[model samples]
Target: MLVRTFGWSFAITVAGLAFAGVLWGWQGLAVVAILSVLEISLSFDNAVINAGILRKLNAFWQKIFLTVGVLIAVFGMRLVFPVVIVAITAKIGPIEAVKVAVNDPDRYQHLVTSAHPAIAAFGGVFLLMIFLDFLFEDRDLHWLAWLERPLAKVGKLDTLSVIVALVALLVTATTVATSVPLQGGGTADKSATVLLAGVAGLVTYLVVGGVSGFFEGRLEEDGDEAAADADGAEETAPARRGGASALGLAGKAAFFMFLYLEVIDASFSFDGVIGAFAITNDIFMMALGLGIGAMYIRSLTVFLVRKGTLDDYVYLEHGAHYAIGALAVILLVTIKHEVNEVVTGLVGVVLILASFLSSVVRNRRLGEGSEQLEEQAEIPSGV
Candidate 1:
């Protein structure tokens, strides 16, 4: 299963490194290695979330995710997205952005970095919504039951997550003092850019998530609605497998999920694209390295689905959403402070590993309890 899932990714990794070596020698190899590691570490939560959604998609959609979806993930996000940002923020044409990326990468990097307050606000809020919406919605299984249970109760209010995100965004605005220059010479107030970008994020989430949720079929599939269900049934509410309840809405559902997935990937890419400048300013090298890492992530998502990791490691999704929540906060805080990529990566790893271990324990106890019950049932009442 592992080999079949990752076969092409392995081949791509070899070709990627060899190509990097041919283009820029050993330094290129080292940079690619560093950037690839950086991308992987930063985006592991993305893989888990991707898997959760991918499992609900039909095989045809999964193929699209692997093929066309990969193209969008790599080139669209890692490559074109940054250039477009540079172009938009700098008021330069695409051609000019391309020239700058190739000829004067340092300037291009600075331009991109300067625009990060807005990027942080946008990515941060969008990710926060994803995390908050997960936690706030009703769920039967709680990794941190003490806190999550209360939040789920409060989630009875439809706008709670959005309200919280806005509050956080407003607070972030207070801390920003420097103004980032806009493309047309007039400066955009740092606070204003952050505010508007964040608002944009919120809107995007509403639109995309709304579209995805509209076509959703069954009540059990609604993880967010799980809180409203009775406790007893919560445990038995099975995760509907790939393309369940399509009945005939499969194509429409798949399209929305596809769009939803792309938007999620784009959100994940914001920080990585900005952070890549810290390693190197050359856009192509950065894209190649990061793209290689992205391919592995996509492959990993597929592996998790094929291996049934989501079902086996039940709490993994909970942990992943928590990591995303942490990341969202980190992204927002970055507007007021400088944070290490390593720190961000470490936090996610810790949350996810903790969750993974917890799942193992739960699974073990459940198995033992089932066995004990079976043995007791076998014994005669007189015995």
Candidate 2:
């Protein structure tokens, strides 16, 4: 199953490298490959988060994520998003922007860097809200249930999230409006743009997230029936096969899964798109490198889901959420100053690795404790 799932990814990577080599020569391929590795390293947390959502998806959506989703990531965001940014900020036609980028790479780099502050503010606050929402939510195994309970009961976190997002939007607006002469003399009206982007991000989160939560809650409410159906279906299915049903309400599960996957993908892409500025200004190169990187991230997401690594590792998803929290704060900090992409990637890799190691240590300790209990039982109760 792993081989079959990853076969396309391997083939695509080889073909993409070959194409990149022909287009930009060996140097470009080498740079893109390096960037891809860097992006993958940085987004390991994203893969774990994605695994949690992907597990709920039907096979069809999973295929869409692997196939059509690659096109959206590689071409849509990596390629088109930059052009869109340039057009909006520079007040130039996208074709002209592309031409300028191709003609004067240095100038294009300047334009992208100039826009970084606003991008940072937008991505930062959006992610921060996400982190806070997850951290404060009432989850079953929450370590600090005492704290979470009071917070969840004080009113819906969703309402609080909206309030926080609104505050962030106002703050971002005030800053962008008041600040004079951003890095370049580029006098683009960024307040409106930043405000719009923030609202869009918040709305996307609420609509997609709220709907998914509603459906998941409903599924849990109908737990016995769903469990019986799942068991019966499993009995009739092949042992090693993928097993998500498209039956009746399960379709809601699939829709919610799709929405959640897209939202998570958007969140993961934030840094990659921003960091591409440091690499090259040629929207083409930036897109190609980052797009290729996104492909691998998506592939990694599918790989984790297929392998049931999330179920096995248990704490891996928790670790990724915590990492997302960290990344969100780092992004918010980047609004006022530079945060190197290398540093961003390294932090994520270290945090995730640390979490994995902690989980292993925890599992081992539990095993030891269990063994000790068993031995004590064997010894006799009085002794």
The C-alpha RMSD of each candidate to the native structure, in angstroms, is 6.5, 5.0
Candidate closest to the true structure, highest TM-score: 1
lDDT of 2 by residue, 1-383 (tens): 76676677677778878888999998888877776776787788888888788877768888888887788777876777666777777999999988877888777777766666566555666666676686657666542456656766653645786786688667766664445355645454456656666677677777777788787766555655556666776644532222332253557856786766766676677788778666655567677677777877887888888888876666677678778878876665555546788888887777777767777877798899999999988997676
- The top-ranked prediction according to lDDT is 1
lDDT of 2: 0.71
Give the runs in model 2 whose Cα sits over 4 Å from its true position: 92-94, 142-158, 168-181, 185-193, 219-246, 380-383
Residue 284's lDDT in candidate 2: 72
Please give the TM-score that candidate 2 achieves against the real structure: 0.82
